[model samples]
Target: MSGFQIGKDIISYVALGDSFTEGLDDPHPDGGNLPQGRYRGWADRFAEHLAGHVGELRYANLAVRGKLLRQIFTEQLPRAVELRPDLVTLCAGGNDILRPGSDPDTLAEAFEAGVDRLRGAGADVVVFTGFDTGFQPVMKHLRGKVATYNMHLRAIADRHGCSVVDLWSMKVLQDRRAWSADRLHLSSEGHRRLALRVCEVLGVPVEGDWSEPWPQVPPLPWREARQEDLQWARQHLVPWIHRRLTGRSSGDGIRPKRPDLEPLG
Candidate 1:
């Protein structure tokens, strides 16, 4: 797609959603006191791109890891509206979809509501479809559910005049290197590519292509694969299950790293 020209008047940008938008697993050594990681995702990268094109830019990221769609709508959406940014990127619903018995239709209804609200506030809204996880051995089962949610997201974006970054269609992400060890979050290179992809959708100029291929690697042995599965279950899956059972979230007491729309330094 060709880059669309953004008006010079557009300045403030706010990002809302969960870990994906929060830039998880893409560590920043100087994350300060933020509960999780630092703010360095596609949102921040987009803001930097905007700043380069338009001079000064104000940006805020209200995303936190482990936030469900409902929580994001109830908590972040209101604040985003209050901020009245010129641009808002919303990438929620993944957390909800991963949960057992979550309904895509129901989730879409809530998601569309937030998009409508952001549009009503006169901000350009951007939404993301969930990635296809069929290649992941443990996450393959959720492919159907993710597909359902992605379908809903596209319809919602169309209805609300919001732009969408179609993650499910990005074949490059099928590479195992695109994902972190937990198979939940994106790796640093993955985040870089994701940023470029978002910029492409937004008609922003980017330095590189997100679809660039990675170096080839040999497949792991069967025994190694099995061992890795056991390790993953022990290190990530079990903890996630525990958190769910105890009614806890990774973002329990975390606050937004950038709560206000200010100059990006």
Candidate 2:
């Protein structure tokens, strides 16, 4: 994708997605989740990268954590189209795939519609395929569904003439350090790496290479690994299940960090 370009005088940009877009684990100040646009995920990072190449870029991130694909389409997509940005980046439908009986084909249909609308509005849209989840524990079971959806996403991108940041091919993300303790979201390093990847997709020059390998580290012993998995189950997995059971969402009252396109500094 080195030759692909959305970098042609992109004056405005909008990002739409869920937790990953929201920067869940990649806190701005390098700590826990903070409010008031502090979660500078890959979108923000990528916007900054663009700002370096262009001038006076207006950026908006209408991505709330835990948002379902349908919710994003009905809720954020309209606002994104309304923003009329020169560029748009979308990565949705992960939460839906996590559900018990979700269908990748159906989800892909909705996703393609959203892409079509954004493209129709004249924005240079960029879509991402979900990361290969085989590295995670229980979540790895959804690999087939994610893979299927990724193929759909690639097809949709081709059909719609949109750029694609294929996260499924980012083999570097398979490392444990790329993920946070919660095991659902990426760490700051992961977000940074993803930012560089998007820069590659858009043909924008950035300071770093995302594919650089991580430094060597000893592997955790079996007992310690097992303990960590148990802790994750107790901490992250259980709450997620409970929220689903109670019809609640992590982003229930959360609003988009940057609802309107604002000029970047």
Candidate 3:
């Protein structure tokens, strides 16, 4: 990837991906309250930050809650091209890699092809590496796969001259507070920090710092932590597995929050 050069004027930007990009757990704040069904994920926050720098930016988010990589290819890619945005940010394949028997190599191959299409569309593309799963009891098992995929992502970015956000190297995300109760989606602070990271990678001037240290708090006792894990397993993990088994999706009836590029104001 050539990387996001400074002073690039991104008049229009679009984001493509799954639940992580959909901002599932992060409720967009309304005044002082956080209303349900309102999500402003990292991409949205980054869009706002970008608008502040570039001025009069139009942004659209095409990410759904449970899309696989192939679905993103078939669904989001064509629409993204049609938009002909000045910049495109894509963070997909996490859902695919979480499934059983999924092959990172095959996933990377398809991912590379998608990058090619976005670049070919004449948009400066940004891609993300999967976060380190080392913090999760279940996901820690997939560390090797995540690492392999991350390697491929860096290589792909290099080949295509794209800007890259390496989540695998973000130590701030390793903290439990950065995650929501579901232990799947990120919390509000997490999204904000990620937005800062995006600005840093893009060489854009943003208000906050992503590397700010987490507030020091006493760690949860082993008993409480395990209890939380069990609860998450029942509430989130089980439901996710059920969907996989039944071929259902959280995004089944849901539509993109921002289907068209709208002025950020």
Task: Evaluate all candidate structures by whole-model CA lDDT and list the values in order.
Answer: 0.85, 0.88, 0.88
If scored against the real structure, what TM-score would every candidate get? 0.94, 0.94, 0.94
Error of 1 at 258 (Å): 0.7
Candidate 2, 199-260: lDDT as tens digits: 88888888888999999999999999999989989998899899999999999889998899
Q: What local lDDT does model 2 show for residue 115?
A: 90
Clash pairs (backbone) in predicted model 2: none
Model 1 has an lDDT value of: 0.85
Runs in model 3 with CA error above 4 Å?
A: 3-10, 31-36
lDDT of 1 by residue, 129-231 (tens): 9988888877789999999989988888877778889999899988878888898999878888888898888877769999988888999999998898899
The worst-scoring run of ten residues by lDDT in candidate 2 lies at 1-10
Residues 189-242 of candidate 3: C-alpha lDDT, one tens digit per residue: 999999999988887788788989998999899999889879988998899889
Candidate 2, residue 242: how far the Cα is off, in Å = 0.5
